[model samples]
Structure formats: C-alpha cells, structure tokens
Target: MPDQDLTVAVTGPTGDLGIALVDALERSRAVKKIVGMARRPFDPASEGWKKTEYRQGDVLDKASVKDALKGADVVIHLAFSVLGAGDKTREINVEGSRNVFDQAVRSRARRICYASSVAAYGYRSENPKWLTEEVPALGTDQHFYSQQKAEVEQVLAKTLERKKATQAYVFRPCIVSGPRATMLIEEIPYVQLSERMPDAVRSLLGLMPILKPVIPDPGTPFQLVHEDDVASAFVSGVRGVGEPGAYNLAGAGTLTMSDIADAIGWYSIPVPDLAVNATAEVISRVPAAPEKLTWVEAVRNPVLMKTARAKKELRWKPKYSGRQTLRALIDAWKREGPEH
Candidate 1:
C-alpha cells in the first residue's frame, strides 16, 4: 500500500489545467513530492511551479512515462491534444493516454486520476439538461477532441478493470477557464481579435453605440469551471477521498448564448441548431482555419453537468461561478496579451 504522504507524477504538466493542478498539489499536505512530465520544460522562474521536478519527455513514449512513474504513488494524467490535426490528436490524446495508463499500472502506482471533458458525453440534441457521471460518453464522431477523450476514457476503463489493485478517478469538467488558458481563448475569433487589439481601438469598440446588435449569439448551453476548481478535484482524488469512478465537475451557475449576449448588452438572436452545425462544418473545411473551430458546433448541444458527485464524494466545491470564471478570463486576456 502507498504511504500517507504521496509522491505524485503528472503528465503534461505545462498545460493550463496542469499548471493549476500543480499549484493545488503544492498547497496540499498529502502530497510529499511532485514529478511533472512534459514535452518541453516549463519556465523555472514561474511562481509556484518552480517546485515541480519536471521530466523532459513525452507521454507517447512509454519508456519516459514509466520512468516518471517510477516512485509515484499516484499518476495524474492531464496530457491531451486539442488544437491539432485529427490524426495527430488521436495519436497523442488516445494513444498517448493509453501509454500513460499502461506505464502507471506497470509501475505499480496505486491510483490514476484522469482529466476527462464534458465533450465526452457527446453533443446531441437529445442530451439532458444536467448530466451526471452515469451518462454515456458517446462523443460525436465529427469532433476529434471529443472522440479522443471518450476513447481515452475507454482505455482507462479497461485499465481499472484489468488492474484490480489500481484505482482510477476521472473528472469530467465542462469548459475550464482561467488566466492560463491562452490557447482556449484563441478558439473564438472575436475574443482573440478584441484581446489582441490596441487599448484605444478596444475602448472605441466598447463605446460603439450599435455594437450590441452585432454580437453573435452563443446559442448553446455553457458550463464553466475554473481551472483551480478542477485542480482541487484532482488533489482530492490523489488524497484518496473520492471513489474509483467518474465525477462531473462544474461551477455554480449556467449560461446560454443569449445570457452572454444580455450580459454584454447585445441583442440575442437564437440561431437554429442545424444552421450552426452546418456553418461549423463549412468553417472546418477551410484549410487555414484552426481545427478548434469545429468545437463551436460540437458544443452546441444543451448538456449542463450536475457536479453533486464531486461535491458530495470528493468534498470539492468551486470557488468561482461560471460567469465569474468567464469574466475573469476575458478581463485577464484584455489586460495581459493572449499569452496565458
């Protein structure tokens, strides 16, 4: 059995949520040491993250993952490819996750905590308003990110079943937002343009009288969770509080496309679901467009997650609301360039 103080190993520790997780683990008394594995070394000067003993390696390479997991009591797998080519994402997200799990099990790590996503629940018109952990992860085939997350969860499932001694905790969080999510902001062109523009231009745009009418409607349900909140859940999982099953992690309130429009003093136009999906498909075909654009359509489904399991079981509560998290991210982007 693992000792009281845990030596944790994290894969992809340079990403947004990964940074948050490292911060959370650093503050926890249960964590004795942290080993971070990433393709490139994180800046040694970063506050709070300097403590992590980062292993310069890739998760796709099984030997490197095994080496990282050598003395780890728990493995926090956060490595995922979101904004890449379809095949590349599959290789990294799916195959890479498989390598991590296999190595963790081989290394005799007692537990594995995975960072799954709400997209794994699949974007369908028939989705329920509040999804729990029991909902099937039938992710849409059209979105490679969603599909890859679901596939990786299956790999985790098989690992938990085959490795009876090893426990697995999966957190399926919705739209994680924070200052560290720089790449995530790039997915929305308007936000990106607004953030990148000069302060005078931004002030001029803010003062434009008729701008509210032109704000594109976000005609889909949005559930935002702060990256720190997700990190807290992983911290709890590593501490052995939660059971070996999937938990839904989300913030307090919900927001719709119209809600966003109203918040920004814009007239909301509820676009038809089919039209949005079709438009997204067309936009994804453009050779120059970022693949993350397809996520716009993939997330159009009306699925709001119920985070009671995380609260009740893991004793995890999000400090920020969805709106609060969103506003903070936007404000941060505006103040600091999109280099999060």
Candidate 2:
C-alpha cells in the first residue's frame, strides 16, 4: 500500500511539465516532500515551492537515477530529449529512460508513473480516428521520437508486468500547452516565421495585422492539454486514485490549424492534404532537422486520443479545451517573448 504522506521523486523538474507537476505536488496533501532531479540548475524556492528540493543530476547517469529515487513512494519519470538532434538525443531518451524505469522498480516504489506521449501511437493514416487504450503502439519508422516513445512504453510494460510489486501508471498526453509552456509554439516554423521579421520588427508589426505575412494552414487537427491539467492528473496518480495502467490524457476536443493560427494572429491559407503530406515527408528526412520537423509527420495524420479511461479511472478532468490551451500558449509567448 502507498503511504498517506508520501515522499515523491521527480525527474526533470526544470521542464514545463516538470514545473507544473512540482507545483501541483507542492499543494498536494498526499505529498510530504518532493525530491526533484534535473540537469539544469533550478531553485524551487524561486518558484515559491515549500516542500520541494532541487538537485542537479542527469537521468543518463545510473547513480543519479538511484539517488533521486531513493525512499520514494511514487516515482515520476519526465526527463526526455525533445529538440536535440542525432544519435545522442536518441540515446538519452531511450537508454536514460530505461535506466530510470529499471531503478524505480528496483527501489520498490509503490506507484511508478511514466509520461508517455500520443506520439507513441505513431503517425499512421490507417490508425483509428479516435485511439483508445487498447490500440497497440505501432510506432513510425520515419522518425525516432514516436518510435522511441512506443519502444519505451513496451519495455516498461513488460518490466512492470514481471515486477508485480510495483504498479505502472502510464499517462499518455498529447501536445501539452498552457500559460507556462510554449516550446512547440515558439519552434514550429509556420508559427515562428509568421511575420518573417526580427523580434523587434515582429513586435512592431503585431499592431498592423494587414502587414503580417500569411502562413499556410495544413488543415490538420491536433489536441492540446493544459500543462496544469497534466500536473493535476499526475497528482491523482500519486494519490493512487485508480487502477494502475495506461490512461490517455487530452483536452476535451481538437483544434484545427486555422484555430492555432487565429490564436497567434496569423493569416493562414488552407493547403490541400496531398501537398502537406509530401512536405511533411521531405521535412522529416532533413538532416539535423528541428524537433518540429519530426512532429510534422504527425501533422500528416493527426493522432486524436480518447480520454475516457483517464476520466473514468483516474478521475481526471481537463479545465481547458484544446483551443483555450493554444490561446494560453500564445498569450504566454506574447508576454515572455520567443527567445525563451
């Protein structure tokens, strides 16, 4: 049984999801203390957190993984390489994640949570319109992100099934966005280059919408979950709200390309599906491509997830819709600037 006043361990507390989860846990009565490990130097006190302690460590190191997870009742794995390119990034995401999962099980954590992505389902045209928990994670061969996410989930599932003492709480969320999270918003070429001006010039141009350049809308739909909602769901897991298994997390609905463009004040012209598909394929193969390009593959065939399991089992409810989530991301970007 899990402890009523738990000692929670978190990997990647510096990330957007990490920050949100840590903030949520700080307010959670179930968590007495939160031990957070990340490569970046961070001060939990700066964030106004009381029960959280920040430690400098990389998930790639086994000793760090063991030390961070020591005496943890619930271990949450969030560290991952997103924008990094080449074989090194792949090694960090896949191998480092395996190390964390292995150590968590060995540490005898009562509840282990892994933040998988909808990308694990892959970008397949033949996939179901609405993927449920039952769908097999058939990862794509085009890029390593989806393939690696799928691979990690499969390995974790197998390991945890054998290690019955520990229960697996795998939450697969799609395109997390919120007031504090805007990596995708800042990096996506279409959104980033909408004005085609320097940061100074773009700010000046913002007042004149007619002078702004137009972006081509691919007509692809996507789901966006607020960063806070993601945090709340993980807190539910830490409290052992329901059965330990995979649960899909997303906003209540989907947002079209036009919706995203409107949120950021971009004038968009819809592109045919055929043209967009060809472009996404070419972009995926670009050497040293941005993480945005790899995600573009999913734009070709948007993966819409069904959050029924999360709602019914995890007792989770998302406060922001996909559209509202995107707006929050845009608002955050406008306030903080794109350099972040």
| Best candidate, lDDT | 2
Candidate 1 weakest lDDT stretch, 10 residues: 189-198
Clashing residue pairs, backbone N/CA/C < 3 A, model 2: none
Per-residue lDDT over 240-334 for candidate 2, one digit per residue giving the tens place of the 0 to 100 score: 98898888899987887778767767676676776565555554464544465666676668799999999998778889988788888888888
Model 2, runs deviating above 4 Å: 1-3, 193-210, 281-291, 338-340
- Count of clashing residue pairs in every prediction: 1, 0
- TM-score of each predicted structure versus truth: 0.86, 0.90
Give the alpha carbon lDDT tens digit for every residue of 1-340 in model 1. Answer: 2246889999988888888788888888888888988898576347556446888998888889888889899999998876673876678888889999988888889899999988888787667778888789888787777788888899999877767878899889887887776444556532333233334433433434344343344456678888888888888889889577899988888877565445444455545555455545555565555575656754466668999888998888789999888777767766786342
For the record, the alpha-carbon RMSD of candidate 1 to the native fold, in angstroms, is 4.9
